[model samples]
Target: MFKLGLLIILAAIVVCAQSIPFLEESNTVAECLASNNITQAEFQELIERSSEEDDLENTERRYKCFVHCLAKKGNLLDSNGYLDVEKIDQIEPLTEDLREVLYDCKKMHDDEQYLCEYAFKMVTCLTDNLEQSDEVTEAEKNTNKLNE
Candidate 1:
């Protein structure tokens, strides 16, 4: 019984170790940007412009345009009310990177008895970025200014 418990613990450790790499790579791109570990020149430009704009609504429109431009460059499209894509082509080469990371993470989970940490990190990173955009920030500012 002790040996069985030890084996289970060891299996869990191995799974966690393997998943670390997958989460590291897959979550790096967006997490870094959101955390400012990755410098986002495009987002900066939009944010700066939004800062200068007189009207929040117009600022938001421009910010949305900037996001659409970025998405075009990234070859990504709106999917499943989320980030879903009909084909990998929508994301260009980065699609392959995402796929590779996801596969590695899932392989680790299935063979090494890991859990879906990568999926959690990936979703969190994406959501964080989506929420931190200039439009959202400006909207918040507008709300605060109105309340005051």
Candidate 2:
């Protein structure tokens, strides 16, 4: 239950409605949750807990599997249980920089043997990169404005 919630929260953090189309679909999330045997209440609780700093590292294996389920459903994972970089590059809202980061993250985890851990690590990598990317972009914009 906790893992399910953590996966959902991680998904939300890395790919909110503006970025990932599948995540915006309630049916998809519901299906993944049901398949994973995670109760809606537990999912909600985990989402709330996601705001805490330590949830990601403490997330359970079930939650990692839940993330894998979501990745499969979203067509983010290839037949080998690795991220499909080609498909990810086609996502309309993802900027080239973000796509590059995704590719790098995938490469970093290429040795993962478990699909669940792979998916979870991918999410974690994405969240960390996205946050850093946002900070960098904001800083660049501020610098550009000052220079102008």
Candidate 3:
């Protein structure tokens, strides 16, 4: 009876975790792109540009608007163009550290004017913070192994 109960609980956890939606749903992405009148090639170019560290500072308005569209679709942005941290906290598969980083980034960009710019800044900030966090984590693990 104990083993059966444990198995059932584990199975339920797996099912719940699997059901958690990805931050961007495919249908939502398509809808947002269509609404924004963005072609896949243009979107790909934006993605490539955003990936380049130096290009982030010069993101085009169209790219920023597309980001805003995605955030709006996901209900991640509040009425004032700021990130709704509460909504962000509910996204599953996000580590506690990542959540903390997100909250910090939201506060950091709290005064952004336009919805498009706010969304774009938040995305960039989160990406940079997460990358830094991963580097720090990796360094810590290496140090611990060395000490061991």
Any runs in candidate 2 off by more than 4 Å, and if so which?
A: 1-7, 10-26, 91-94, 145-148
Across residues 24-128, which tens digit of lDDT does each residue of candidate 3 receive?
A: 244765676677787777765544544333445554576567667666766665677666766655655556776687679878888887777777667666666
Worst 10 residues of 1 by lDDT: 1-10
Query: How accurate locally is residue 45 in candidate 1, as Cα lDDT from 0 to 100?
Result: 54
Residue pairs with backbone overlap in model 2 = 3-63
C-alpha RMSD by candidate, in order: 20.4, 3.8, 12.1
lDDT of each: 0.35, 0.72, 0.59
TM-score for each of the candidates: 0.22, 0.80, 0.72
Query: What is the TM-score of candidate 3?
Result: 0.72
| lDDT (Cα, tens digit) per residue for candidate 1, span 3-62 | 222222222222122233433445433443454322466545544554344342222233
Q: Indicate which candidate wins on lDDT.
A: 2
C-alpha positional error of residue 39 in candidate 3 after TM-score superposition, expressed in Å: 0.4
- Sort every candidate by TM-score, greatest first: 2, 3, 1
Winner of 2 and 3 under lDDT = 2
Error of 3 at 59 (Å): 1.5
Ranking by lDDT: 2, 3, 1
